[model samples]
Target: MLTEAEKAATLWIQTGFTDRTVIQAAVAEPLLAGQSVVGVAPTGSGKTLAYGIPALSRLVPGAGLQLVIIVPAQELAIQIRDVLTPLAKTLGLGFQGLIGSANRERQVKKLREKPEAVVATLGRFVDLLEERKVVLEEVKTLIVDEFDSFEPDALRDILSFRRGGLPKQANLGLFSATDNPTIVSEFQAAWPDLQVINETSTDNSRGVVHHLLLDRQQAGKIQVLENLAREKHQRVFVFFNHKHVLQKVASELRFKHVPASMLVTDGRQVQRAEALQDFRSGRVPLLLTTDVAARGLDVADVTAVVNFELPDTLTTYIHRTGRTGRQGANGTVYNLGDDHDLRDLRKLVGDRVALETEPGEKKAYRKSAAHSAGADETRGVERQTGAGHRPGKRLTSAEEEAASAKKRKKKKQRWRNKKNVGKHW
Candidate 1:
């Protein structure tokens, strides 16, 4: 029987139409009614607890792996494991992470001992499944967190696990920070009657101020970054597009004596984890990263998000900017781009944000004068060279005409040579 607190929690879950509200509703309604359920929520919205609290409340005392949460990155798996550990302890439920970077032998050994809930990434989870190391037929709940990041291939691998034949009405929860229309539509088509609770509006209540910096050249952008870094002195996340560019920018900052670190996918797992830890612990004030840090990973106390290089896609832009201003903190996003680039970004952000120009600044190209000077020099060269002659040389009209006649004679000779060679062959 559900306790009064749990019942109230369920009621709270059902009342709001936000992402968190919807998730609470799904968890409570299904468990209360003895039916399986799925809950979809945004990133950083306490998704782990939304499903975890209910799963723990409903689990049999020593049941093993009754709930399995699959995430895209190892960082997310570790994060989920951390969130569930205390709750599991209170409920006397066992929990273990089946992440890739961790010791596989140890994970398998832990599995041998039978844990109640297992959090894992898709690749490693599939590996365990293929090895017959985990039995999912008894899995009461399967929560696929960040389903949008799960490519079709990963989803296919997950669907194959159903071959083990789970209960006819097992709970399936797909959670994401983004409510991609295409993903939602496809998901509904697949499940037909899957209940969806849109929580994007509520999830965005975390107090993030978005800004776009336009008409800034690469040099000017670097200056802005330096100024902001010195002024804020808070932990910052600078997102870039290419790995090479990420490293290059970090190197440039270091050259300028700026304390900065970088996290890229190509680095070893330990290195990446250390970078993240340093940034989170505030030892490193600035973190330059690729999209590897954009999704699912949680880093509290980030003061600002600097898009050193703008993301090409809207989803990516949202995720990048969403990193800061999390948990109701007043965080700002600085989008550094040229005018053309800002236009593209504006289209992505739509009317959600208004573009504001920096006050007391005139929009002018500093290189225009230099370009005109170069054009004048080229014209001077042309005047010296005369009409039919190449630049950098003076030629009289008679010399120019003679040169043209000589060129024509050479062309006729070349054509004759080609014709003779063809005839002889």
Candidate 2:
């Protein structure tokens, strides 16, 4: 009694996957039937394949641009393309990606071949549409990944695309980890009969995440990172509040011979790809980045997430911590800051996050980090307690106090800079 699309999905699952996840199973039939759907699932819950498999199953080979998937970031677009390539191949479908940084001429050339599917970022996709390089008349399904992350202007563009570019009978799919009511209302207004599938209530896809606090002075954070890097099996994502701190920490770690990668929002695309590849392939164990660059990052082996400093908002906190403990993989979240920062983090997350506070579980890691300072010295880099100078010997109490005062001043400046960012300094 299986439909063709269901039978195709069964083949895909039998090929490699063990079984369909809840979100995947729920949305497959509807999506395959060409019905519009909004799927909300937890992070790393295989939303890609949930929508991707059904979409591909419904595609006709050699069709010109039948499926258009819009993502918020270039990296995510590439990730999806890479993930679905094998599946697309199995279905005899040609898939391609349109990202802002990739060569425009090359993309246009590829478009002439009549690819069946295209994954893209909004900016580049819009540009192609404006240039008449892409035709949506034949498009059957349009998917927007991470719908909640789109800005207002981008959302307007998406609405315009749905109205003007796409065919009247085309299906729309929106997927995100969290749903904002206002955005959902806007979509519902646009498509009054849109179907919503919120799996968060019964979603058991996320693994256990140990939220532990590492209450250390700013100077000692680098030493702790060094300690973590010594662990060969740990792949950590270190989040920072500012790009400057990320740059400094990355530089210091590299100077100490730690194989760490740095990813920035405005960096060159090739370098960004290289950095991500290095981390993904286990060539480097640490990836230090800010929120913008790390958004929607889906790496399976990320065993730990380190908050170099707490994020500015709760949504940001959720996105950062969600990087770990993904897809039923047990992971750890280490919040690295002073006591004041720890209190602020608790206030920011409220009852949503459970921080480990037991003496044995929490204090054990702190004790280990403190004792590892001596171990770091054997690598020929002295323990750094603050920015600027590296003294040959350890600092006295007065020096430590002065360093703490300077650190406080720097934090205030950072806040001011953040508030005044994008304005004339």
Say which candidate scores most in lDDT: 2
lDDT of 1 by residue, 70-128 (tens): 88887788888887777677656788999777789998998887888889988888889
Model 2 residue runs over 4 Å out of place are 1-3, 358-425
Candidate 1 accuracy as TM-score? 0.76
lDDT of 1 at 30: 54
Clashes (candidate 2): 1
| Tens-digit per-residue lDDT, 1-425, candidate 2 | 55556656565774588876789888888888888899988777788998998898888887688999999988899899999878888777899999999999999998888889999999999999988999789999999999988999998898887677688788889998787778877877766667999887687878777676656665557755765676667788999988998998888787667789998988999999999999988889899988778877799768788899888687777778887777787777778776677778878888988765312123333356644553344222211211111223332233453564356456744211333221110
Report clashes for each candidate as comma-separated counts. 3, 1
Q: Show the lowest summed lDDT stretch of 10 residues, model 2.
A: 380-389
Using TM-score, give the best candidate's number.
Answer: 2
Error of 1 at 287 (Å): 1.7
